[model samples]
Target chain A: MNIQLIAEIMGTVAFAISGAMLAIERKMDLFGIVFLGIVTAAGGGFIRDMTLGIVPPAMFSSPMVLPLAILSSLAVCALVAWLYKGSDEELHGERFQWILNFTDAIGLGLFTVAGANTAIDSGYGDYHAFVIFLGMLTGVGGGMFRDVLAGIMPAVLRKHVYACASLVGAICYLGLLCAMPRGYAMFTGAMIVVVIRLLASHYKWNIPRVM
Target chain B: MNIQLIAEIMGTVAFAISGAMLAIERKMDLFGIVFLGIVTAAGGGFIRDMTLGIVPPAMFSSPMVLPLAILSSLAVCALVAWLYKGSDEELHGERFQWILNFTDAIGLGLFTVAGANTAIDSGYGDYHAFVIFLGMLTGVGGGMFRDVLAGIMPAVLRKHVYACASLVGAICYLGLLCAMPRGYAMFTGAMIVVVIRLLASHYKWNIPRVM
Candidate 1:
């Protein structure tokens, strides 16, 4: 399989898991949780494709996206159940949270690059600027959507320069798009976002509150 | 003033009043009520314009919409208060509901004609069939929006087939454009919707439930 196809599957899996975990946290019913997970993973990409006048968005066009959504959601539910088993017994477990956080950071980093790269490669009168802008948005947009449906303030509006981290990743990807060897640029872009997000969270960084 | 502008203002006023009354029923704060009212009144039109590629939308672009929103909301609040004071001990008033239903029918009828006419008049392509479809939606879409935000089932999903009613109005308007004089066609079409809504509601004529 092509690298782009692998990237798409990885991104779908990462987002679907995050989406399902949120629905479980929100105490949604099983069907609702699954629906939310699928919507969250595919919503941004679906909208982006529709806006670009592309028919049958990748989520619907690709067999892999649907399977990934279902599997990822189930996996997330099982993981959450296992991790939260101790919640009623005593304190919330910190160990599971650390692992969850680690996986999430990797997901976020990888998704950002994947989204940006796809926009750039699509080559439908969308050049560098549109690609960078749209890519960063596609990466973070689904999470923002999940937050809204779950009736929480979006993380973009709340914490840690989350969208900016995506932006920086996009910039890194662009900088090295023509210069570096193929895989190096992708790796560097993902690394930038991952490190930035981890560091920003640790320091409790935030964008300036609107005046 | 343009005839189109006048019609738009009338529609905005009717929609805003309906929304404000709903917000008051919910016992929201004054700001919340006004905000809900204005957004509900204007949102569908704003969306319609955007999808038609009219950026910033006339509801935001034209100076009239915001002022009309504030005016209509305040007028509705004041009128409701006056009606309550003027009524006797039973206090089971439905004058507000009657006014909203009446004006809402007119607004829907007018908006559908305006939307389709504008598309045809603009020398827009055959793709303007989509714009006409949008127009039909814009008429009833605001109420659907208000219902969802108020935590009620959307009227289009439940009531006297609201979207279908608008579709009927659109069809009549199209027919008028084809054979009859527009003025006669417009009035007859509006009457058809208003009379149908009133008669349907009186007999508890609900749409059949589907899976």
Candidate 2:
């Protein structure tokens, strides 16, 4: 699959899992859980599009977005059901945060490359390095918000190297797009982020306090 | 003060009050409460301007908006602290939903008229009536969202004729703008909405059920 398609699938799966876990944890009504699942999957992209001045936003205007959201929701529901069936502990009680980290890393990697490419193509100034950075942040910002609203520690703040990975990839994307094939550069950037994030997860890498 | 200025103040006060109440109920720290308060006071207006294709998002660009938000936050926090002083029971308990209704009415009336006038002044056609109507909804829509997120029943879903008051005033303003003096018509629309909303509150006027 092309990188765009791959990124879309990655973002959709990660977001869907996050939503499903939140719904099951909160014990929301079935419909509410489904609604949240959809929102959690697509909400970040929606916000990103709006901030970029994409008229009419994406979810409402795109055929693929809704189907992707629905499929993602079903995938997450099935996974959670199977996992919960095996154990009596809550769906989001203990293992949820760990799931969130992997999902978040996937989101961070894909969205950083996507956002950087989008900015470069939009005829915005190269100085919109800031916009690329902002887009990467916006992509994961919604989940951070969701966690805060749910009164849990935000994954980004959990010494998880969350935003750092995105920042690195975004910079890498811009640098590689300067001289290389766009596809190669994007893949390289995304892979770097996902690997760094997962390695950080395995080794518990975190920024030390400067003070 | 100009009527528009007065309306803006009323809307800001109401918006801030709702934010403060939610913060207190959520037990958020002072910084979190202030952040919510600022977003609450400015959020609707920001949405309105952005949808209208105005740039820089007036809330961020205009110095006046920031101070207004701060003042609104101060007013709400001071009032609540005074009223519920030493009464932790009421402060942290299942309180009645009175203040929500009060602030919602004022916000709905002010924003609908403000939005309609802005649209009309821009020389857009009557099809833009839908846009003005949308602006009215966006004003109250954020609060409805806030309440829902706060786990309270949405204010608009209640029996009160909230959105109806704004809709009526917007229509009345559109009608009378052509026949009467412009300034007079503006005042008349504002009064009509306020009076109707207050009457609805006291008499429990509501749209009949769709069954």
lDDT of each: 0.68, 0.66
Q: Candidate 2 lDDT, tens digit per residue, A1-211?
A: 5766567666766776676667667766666666666776667667666655786766677667667766776677777777778664665474676786677667667767776665555555344444454456555665666666566666654444666677778777778877798788878888888898889889977553201
**Alpha-carbon deviation at A121 in model 2, angstroms:** 9.8
Off by over 4 Å in 2: A1-42, A55-93, A101-211, B1-6, B25-28, B89-100, B209-211
The candidates' DockQ values read 0.05, 0.04
Error in Å for residue A211 of model 2: 32
Report how far off residue B199 is in candidate 1 (Å): 25
Model 1 TM-score is 0.56
Best by lDDT: 1
Interface RMSD of each: 11.4, 10.1
Kindly report the fnat of each predicted structure, to 2 decimals: 0.00, 0.00
Model 1: per-residue Cα lDDT over B23-97, one tens digit each: 766667778778867876787786566545566777778898888888888886777678666554323346656
- For candidate 2, the TM-score is 0.62
